[model samples]
Target: MSGNSRYRILFAGTPDTAVPSLDALVGAGFTIAAVLTRPDALVGRKRVLTPSPVAARAAELGLPILRASRLTGDAGRETLGRIAALDLDAAAVVAYGALVPAAGLEMPRHGWVNLHFSLLPAYRGAAPVQHAVIDQAAQTGACVFQLEEGLDTGPVFSRLERDLQPGETSGAVLADLAVSGAELLANTMGAILTGTATAEPQRGEPSLAPKLNQADGFVDAARPAAAVAARINGTTPEPGAWALLEMASAPAEEAGERPAQQRVKLLGAVPEELPEGTADLPLGDPLPGHLHRGRTAVHLQCADGTVRLVQVQPAGKKPMSAADWARGLPEGTRFQAEATAETATEGP
Candidate 1:
């Protein structure tokens, strides 16, 4: 790394978002020792074998690739030997799914670095962007950290912050942070090559960002509208916010054992106040998820207030505006209040 030649960097990544970091390092004139990516997998409609996004990019760049399915046991040692053979100055990981065993971590003289989304010690795990938006964080960013034995528990070299704009979806926030973090990672590498960068142990209240799943996207009506709105924002374009609206007015014959409720995925929503008298209600209003139909928009009473639906997708149908979904609903239909609310907190 101290030589006159360009620093040799081993890049490990799998997804599309991680491509920017690779590009940044290459654009900054770093000689990528080799690219490490996940093995090809069956993807899409026909289930054809397809390379990961990073792998595709590495192919385009004509970089050497190390396809790893597991980085443990004999495989880990083989990967370590490969790293040693490369004589890498350092290795950078961005959303590399597999764990980097200690052998791989210690192989690079300059150490293994990770470009993690979210300011470290907070939202540190697989799904930081989703958790940040779910927690309604005003601002979140990226950090470059030395990958150690712990899960994202490492010394931080640099940090960059991005504002969480109003109604921004998790996907949008991640996209923005990817670009900034890619730039930060490249700069951090440049500084390290010059022996100017320093890393300190992470501080503050640490929180876990566990992987998000379909269950995490449920919009439980028993919770306040803002909380439901958070789910919509955080879950968009993935396991999108889903709920079951009850058709109270529909006859049993019409329903015909249709499970009483219809499933809907919320693509867009805005937490807002219920109109006029509906907001006041009785002191102990019993119906929390009562549907309130409007001419142009659809409003529904919630635990604390109401939510105006923007866009949604019903089961077996294409995505459509909330107003359109509401128009198709039977009269006096409402979303059933969740029997039990999710007790999990987003983050510290």
Candidate 2:
């Protein structure tokens, strides 16, 4: 302890997920020198420029704020210079989007410890939480580790594991972890500041979780129903899982344009079981992404089984039950990667 006082540290992160850790540090009586976050940028559907969640939280705490941008070359150097002037005992990072070059990493006395949202040596990169859900991982958790130049290849201080539940979206799972991890992070800090914590290099082969894109949310009919459900869960409340629901037969319009596809975001779903008296369920024979109805539910065929879309939001429309959508569809409609104008020529 510095003169039996709270450890003076720097907090750096940008997203809402990172807010809890900073708040925990304050609760633990850490003297935060300054909070560093990415510069405010355009956000939301209306594209409003807004401060990062970390910056806003810092403001509420009355902590000094440092707005950093595009951490590279001269800009990186300038930011490092300002950080050095703060004379931090340690720096704690959680979900900070920018990579801290080794130059900045080496400046602190205890070095920078990152609160990564994963068990080290697995899913070791950005978007780990979402990747874990997409991959249907049975378990995942948080790791408090020292930051190194090679991705998440750092020495681990502590970890807190959490189970992945069926149909639980990454957003929900992470919300739980972000709050719990904050306490784990605060406890780990107390040990480090008092010189009791140990750092061990991560073990096992590491898997990379590259950043996800819009294409990742595309639900393919060729995948298993369980896989589709996982994709929907993984991508929900973000870029979102989507499908182009269509049919084989349709009235031809004089304009010759392919009818605009029903672009619906998958918010919730469940694997469908063969209902009583239903024929032996076809896992693969049906056209993949084909839509069907069972009295009150909407079912989509996949390579291995069927899934019921519970909640969906059509683009430009409010969310509604998938059953309601199915009620309006022709008996044998299917989903496609994209509809073609040429398909309009196909007979009913």
Q: Could you tally the backbone clashes for each prediction?
A: 0, 0
Error of 1 at 195 (Å): 0.6
Candidate 2 structure quality by residue, lDDT tens digits, 1-348:
443145779999999999999999988888899999999999879999999999999999999999887456888889899999998889999988889887888888999999999898999888899999989899999999999888999999999999998788888998899999999998898888889999998999799988888898888656767888888888876668888876545453345656546777888777776465443245734556667666777777766667878887877988898878667776546687332333322321
TM-score of 2: 0.89
Cα lDDT of candidate 1 equals 0.83
Score every model by TM-score.
Answer: 0.88, 0.89
Model 2 lowest lDDT segment of ten? 339-348
Q: Write down the lDDT that model 2 would get.
A: 0.83
